[model samples]
Each structure stands twice: as structure tokens, then as C-alpha cells.
Target: MRMVTKKQVPPLLLALGASVLALVFLLAFQGWIAHGADIFLSLAQAGLSWCF
Candidate 1:
């Protein structure tokens, strides 16, 4: 019987993960995500204010 002690992550997988993160940041910086986040935050704040 043989046992595997260690597992390795592929470089391609790491590169893909980094690229996806970078794309998300790029979009956020361009206001694609920031706009949506602003709307969400304002709605949440309004809702909280109305509750009190």
C-alpha cells in the first residue's frame, strides 16, 4: 500500500485565481461594482434609519 503525504497546487490554477481577482478589482474601480455597492449601502442605511 502507498500513501500520499503532500499535495501540490498547479501554477495555472494560481494564475487563474489571481487574474479573476484582478478583473474584479478593475471592474470595481471602474464603478461597475462600486455603483451597485453604493446603492446597496444607501438602501441599507435608509432601512436602518426608518427602523429607529
Candidate 2:
């Protein structure tokens, strides 16, 4: 019997990271992230600001 007591990252954060990675991959495939990087970046910046 193994005692796995190590704490793990929260499931929600894991899921969010996975989803974000998938979205990044999809955008890369469409060349949208590269071409419109500034636009998306600004959106992300705005979103972060909204949290404060």
C-alpha cells in the first residue's frame, strides 16, 4: 500500500492551463496568434487589469 500524500495543483487550474494551451495551439494553426499577437496581447492585458 502506497501513501501518496503529496499535494497536487488544483484541478481547475490544470483544466484552465490545458484549455489555454489548446486554444494557443488552435490559434497557431490558423496563424492568428502570430499575425494578431498584439491584438490578443492587448486583450489579455485589459482582462488582467479588470481583475484589479
Q: What's the TM-score of every candidate structure?
A: 0.51, 0.48
Judge candidate 2 at residue 19 and give its lDDT. Answer: 100
Global CA lDDT computed for model 1? 0.78
lDDT of 2 by residue, 1-52 (tens): 9997988999999999999999999978788646566766687887853442
Look at candidate 1 and give me any clashing residue pairs. none
- Clashes in predicted model 1: 0
Per-residue CA lDDT of model 1 for 1-52, tens digit only, reads: 9997887789999999999999998987788555766766777877853442
Give stretches of model 1 more than 4 Å off: 1-4, 32-52
Model 1 residue 32 lDDT score: 52
* Count of residue pairs whose backbone atoms collide, per candidate: 0, 0
